[model samples]
Target: MAQDKEFEIVREFEVDATPEEVWTAITEGTGGYLWPMQPPEPRVGGAAAFGSTVTAWDPPHHLTIRSEDVGFPTQSANQLEHTVEPRDGGRAWVRYVHSGIFTDDWDNQYDGASRHTDFYLHTLREYLVHFAPRPVAFATVDGPAASAVPEGLEPAARALGLTAETAVGERVTVRGPHGRPVEAVLDHRDAYFIGLRTDDALVRFFGRGHWGAPLGISVHDFAPDADAKENGAAWQEWLDGAYA
Candidate 1:
């Protein structure tokens, strides 16, 4: 039998800017200032000094750093990795993954990591949204209420309940098959939403909040409702034509 030794935390954010703009923030801009504890060198083999060693680096794309003082011998080789990818509509998405051991005081470490990750992400967003060529807005929703329906979704609203509200700062959660549920957020002004379902899959929906535009959605294992399914197809078609 295989042991569940993998412990990790992953986060993703969409930035209303090009990959280069977002890349600078993560490697050479405000992100460096905020996380002084672990400044990224942002080049292959470049060291990330801050009581830690950068194990790997790939400019404008990926960086991995390791911290020995992570508070647990078992996780002494703890590593954190960041990746950036460009998407449609002059936007980019960033993903951060931190993997390490569970300390005896796991709660404290978890809290600290969570806070730091959030701070870094928010700071990065602020920088990109403020300085990038295009405007950007960031929003996030948490808790069980995030997954609940608003009680009176119109036919259209019901069909596009979560997909329709892709405006910045909108969040929705809907009960999934079985006792599992789905939660999602529209980050920045990109026509996309980040979704998390009970199945633990990270999902992405493209062109969700484009008014008078078609919508695109993607999730693993679960299929969208009949109406939502059609809307997604149309949304993608519109984007292909409009952006192309």
Candidate 2:
């Protein structure tokens, strides 16, 4: 007989923002960073997105939410908890935990989710410190199927002038969709992920093919006139051109 296995990911970090600011960033769906969340009802036992329910809610301090038992044969019980505290020098310390159970393909699911948590939290800090108060237009696009191989991200990286030798904090200017110039700095880099930040936007690239999915890009455009749908389509065109 088969069995279910449990996994939990915990992360702690400091961000250069007050607890209230961090709280707004984490709980709002402003799309300034990471995935956008639907506004959850602000109380314990209230409804949340993704078939989850709010188990605990405390403003600027703590929160716990869990997924309902959806009866997916291979998985159940996804929970997330977050705690925030004020720190010296106008900063905040954050602790995050995500726990769940899986009945199959445990290793791949665990690795992907864990690494994604790190990247998402890093982006959260970036948003709180630099891009708060601006409404963001977010766009996410996946590369063509041809880009779904071991080196799935290399083409996009090369198009953006990134390489294996690229180091964090390195600055580069690349032409984005519609020949728009993106003057930015490399904020994060690793074997399977890349992040670029401009004065008005955060651009993230995921080499998901390393784990059996297509390479992808997400842009958080903070300009006052940004359009999410147009941005997504333009990036999709750019990606198609790159693979062509």
Candidate 3:
């Protein structure tokens, strides 16, 4: 006889907070609301289910869950395990691993698991940033000259204060200290925006545009590291490189 193999999905995040703080956010606070599942009580044998069942639980550290078999329009029995580890400098690394034997189509199920883990990590960031917040926004280029912005770059530029003008099909560039300028184009389908961090001069590009009226990014009090300026510069470098 041969042992059956299980499917698994894993996600990781670097949180700028203490392990205890992150744990509270996950177990006691906003973690449940962000993910597409009910709030987990998260106790030993506490029966946690996020489209599944609770198999194992350990506070401020690990959670193991299992899904049951159901037909199409539902899911099969899949096991999910989450782990949190404290890192240096008040940061934490959280990983979500999902495993199970899939009788169903593997690709579709794996894709779904990837999406779920992405959402989970995103929600975790939201919670941590809320506790240690900043000012951010998503801005769309709303004008006739939107054609001047680059394709797949408007949302990101808008987050960084780029706006549309009357010049249709015109190309505009915002130069950095080095290399070619970051180009922006205007198009009809380019209607979405990107996530911008205004506290510092940096914009982050996300795959999907935010869905809602523009909301003000919240600012919270967290002690800046001794190398705060260096960190900001490094982030800016990464953004420039990414957009370049």
Scored against the true structure, residue 159 in model 3 reaches a CA lDDT of: 38
Q: Per-residue alpha-carbon lDDT of model 2 for 89-157, expressed as tens digits?
A: 988999999998977678877898899899888888888888996889999999988887778878888
Which residue ranges in model 3 land beyond 4 Å of their true spot?
A: 1-5, 30-33, 50-52, 69-74, 131-244
Clashes of each: 3, 0, 13
Ranking by TM-score: 2, 3, 1
**Alpha-carbon local distance difference test for all models:** 0.48, 0.86, 0.47
Worst 10 residues of 1 by lDDT: 138-147
Number of the top candidate by lDDT? 2
Backbone clashes (count) for model 2: 0
Worst 10 residues of 3 by lDDT: 212-221
TM-score of each: 0.45, 0.94, 0.48
